[model samples]
Target: MTRPRLLPVPLAPLPNELIGSYLNRLADANRLPIRRIDALIATGRHHSRDKDDLTGWTLSSIERLAALTGRNSPALIHALPSLAALAQPNPLPTPPASLTPTAWKTKVCQLCAASRGVHGLAVQRTYPHQRICLQHQRWLGGRQLPISPRFHELIRANIRHRRLLRGHRDPLQPSALHDEARTMTSRWFSNNNGPLELQRTWDDRLQMLNPDTESDPHDDRNLIEMVTYPETVVLTTLLSKPHNPVHHDFLAEVIRSFGLDPRSLPALHRHTTLPSSMRNPDTPSHPSRHRPGSKSTA
Candidate 1:
């Protein structure tokens, strides 16, 4: 039996030592263990050392990585053809050296809205619901060969309610068959900038939007579950507060949970009463009205 010939990992062959050196420096500065270093190296290698693969990072991430590597990612990206040549079966083609990283990401056929999965043989989604990626999605998406149940569900969700999934609402038309209350509900959706999510389609229309024709309005309850907030923002709103007091305790809990300083919060002063609008037309009398006889000697 013949022993298999093993290929040695090629470290020294990388065109520019700059990124490699900085990665090494990071390993040293962070006191990164050998395992961590190997993982990092493997990660870079897994991409087949393609420069465009490197550019897939958000520009901000690239900037941060540059700060880490002590080399400008933009410059590194500019030198990509030379760099990517080191990788076999280079995924990107050699074009004019003038292309920039952001330009490259923007140019990649994958990002083009027109080329998405439903649009492709892959049957994978072009637009992800804030999670999942195109490749595995394609492999699993049976349309490629074996169809994906998840892809079907996702497509059904998107097609069944395209506008709603995108957080848009349906247009309500006037109909006398519906009562004034129902009319108000439909128009409310128009006013609130909705085709709310499937669940929210039944939420109270009195606040911001109108009820939908999609489901029974009478059954509406607890429609806030679908809400997903941005990572940086934390909403700590009050709930189940007293009608009269407006419940200060719940408000405090919200503030505490939000981790927002009251000082930074907008000033809110409570008024014991509404505006009286009383007009006092009194002019202070000079010395004449001031107890004329009391200080008259002055």
Candidate 2:
């Protein structure tokens, strides 16, 4: 029986690393063809991800590679971000069978791909709901790509958005708030008198924020920019809160800021109550006249 050769570098896998990336790195560092590395761990000649044998890897192959790399199987597997979800009690749903790897690039975080020591693109950090890279405080718009000119305003709001996720432990809030933010911005831009000029101004400002987008003016304006805006997120957060006597006027005030009459928003009235209905001895001068949590008339 032939003894398996040990890796020259014996690099330990990083957290959230992809199995494919690890194999590629091992092959690159050892000056070996990637296909040879693939053959060493492959259970058969089956190719996944279209002729990428690494994608069709099996557990026995992982164990074999772990030994070759001088790392434990469990540790190696734990470091695989793509497989991490499978370990959960409720694993993520499998992707559609017809979808190809090329169709899935936008799902991953761009900044993580640009990280040092990464061999190539890693698929482990792909969470489509995640529009912001909290680690880099940048936007992840494309495959392993980060948008430029990181907007301090949007970054600050994204921190609060993450806070809401952590503070409440609600997985749904991020997407819900994100959706509402886009809706608010779309509504604002939809019925405006100077839509073209306003859109041009917004596009120009957005270009300043992400200079790469300026090179391609024909590209559709990224909605994530609107969704991550501080004002948009602030309103979305406030709207997500439970309706109370304290919030009715506050919500109405925010609605009015978009140049629309508060009275036109019946849904807002339904979700919030008038302050007058629950006013105490410490109540302010008027119900619809003050912002929430404030002790003054509007």
* Candidate maximizing lDDT: 2
Stretches of model 2 off by over 4 angstroms after superposition? 1-4, 45-57, 85-123, 128-136, 143-150, 172-201, 210-298
Note the clash tally of each candidate. 11, 2
Model 1: per-residue Cα lDDT at residue 178: 16
Q: After superposition, how far is residue 286 of candidate 1 from its true place, in Å?
A: 59
Q: lDDT of each structure?
A: 0.28, 0.53
- Cα lDDT tens digits for candidate 2, 104-141: 22323444555656544444433323566778755555
Worst 10 residues of 2 by lDDT: 98-107
Cα deviation at 186, candidate 2, in Å, is 7.1
**Candidate that scores best on TM-score:** 2
Q: Tell me the TM-score of each prediction against the true structure.
A: 0.17, 0.56
RMSD per model, one decimal: 22.0, 10.4
Show model 1 residue runs off by greater than 4 Å. Answer: 1-67, 73-128, 138-151, 155-298
